[model samples]
Target: MFGLILDVTARIHYALRGLMPTNVLLDALHTRRGLKWGVPAMLLAVPYALAAVFCTSQVEAGGSGWFNLLALIFAWNALKFLVAGPLTLMRLLWVLGREANARRRAARALLGEGFGPELVEEPVLTSRRA
Candidate 1:
């Protein structure tokens, strides 16, 4: 169970890491290090419990024990998504935040003080549909 959990965790963590904006998730979770991973893991509980039912049903239907075990493992995979996915994404953002800060600091150092206001925020480009 532990190995299965870890394997699924590593796979899904890396997979979904790039799906959303890092800064946004960081703002939502309010942590540079990691936070979003916490509650979202609870979502896995549903799929896991469902998989458990599937596994038991397979058993009752005379499926191989190995198949039941596989189902249980897959269910745990769902749980792992709940655990590691959000956290991994958040941690990835923190890593990105660290790099971004480093670059900004370097730029400011080169610019040598009095570089007023955040430079070049998202530009508002308004265009009407043709």
Candidate 2:
């Protein structure tokens, strides 16, 4: 039972690590970097949400099918800003708050103590222009 729980937890942690933005996650974990990138992203989202609301009002007045499609796009953008974006950030914080395998791996890498399989470098691309 204990082993099963550990396995599940490790998998969950691994998934969370993959979801995380590497630099941001490492900065947040190692130092106490707060809202450096997150604040800018949220600030940008605000105007988009407001624009969506304005478009919604305009679309209602028009009562045209084509405009409805535009309204749908506006609504999607608004929902991403007002709902999904914040929820994602909240989830990230929640995941980061706990002790996980990701944190261990990060710490190990930072301390130059890695002991897994070596990473392979990406191949260089050469462009030929005629």
Candidate 3:
């Protein structure tokens, strides 16, 4: 029952350990917190990503290529941290939220002993990543 949810979160935390920030991993198990951190992270990331891409295009075009090397590296890492990291957190949170909701509903139905409620035999598998 509720243990399943905790189990899934633990697995995710274990797998993602040291690969991302602790806050992002913690947020991945809850929707509201995930969105609160993820949205701002995503918003802050766009500029860096855009800057990286634009700089890359400029370098590829052979215009001031060498001069933009430092900027390119900084922007690339920033995009990876600010955009990709938080995006991963948010997606994992979404999947976990859906599975949790399904489990909760199933538990409620079982407790109420209501008929016509479909039983969840196992935790739902989702394509989301941590």
Q: In candidate 3, what residue range of length 10 has the lowest lDDT sum?
A: 119-128
Q: Please give the RMSD to the true structure for each candidate, in Å.
A: 12.0, 16.2, 14.6
Expressed as tens digits, the lDDT of each residue in 47-114 for candidate 1 is 66787888888888998888777676667666655555666666767788998897777666544543
Q: Which stretches of candidate 3 lie over 4 Å from their true place?
A: 1-35, 46-67, 85-93, 96-100, 112-130
Give the per-residue lDDT digits (tens) of candidate 3, residues 1-130: 8999999999998787657553454456345445455544556556666777787778778878563885666575566556645566668677779978978886775646543344445433333354
Listed per model in order, the count of residue pairs whose N, CA or C atoms clash below 3 Å is: 2, 0, 0
Q: Across residues 72-97, which tens digit of lDDT does each residue of candidate 2 receive?
A: 66666545444433555665676677
- Candidate 3: residue pairs that collide: none
After superposition, candidate 1 runs with Cα above 4 Å error: 1-52, 113-130
How high a TM-score does candidate 3 get? 0.34
Q: TM-score of every model?
A: 0.42, 0.36, 0.34
lDDT of model 3 at residue 38? 55
lDDT accuracy of residue 125 in candidate 3: 38
What is residue 52's positional error in candidate 3, in angstroms?
6.9
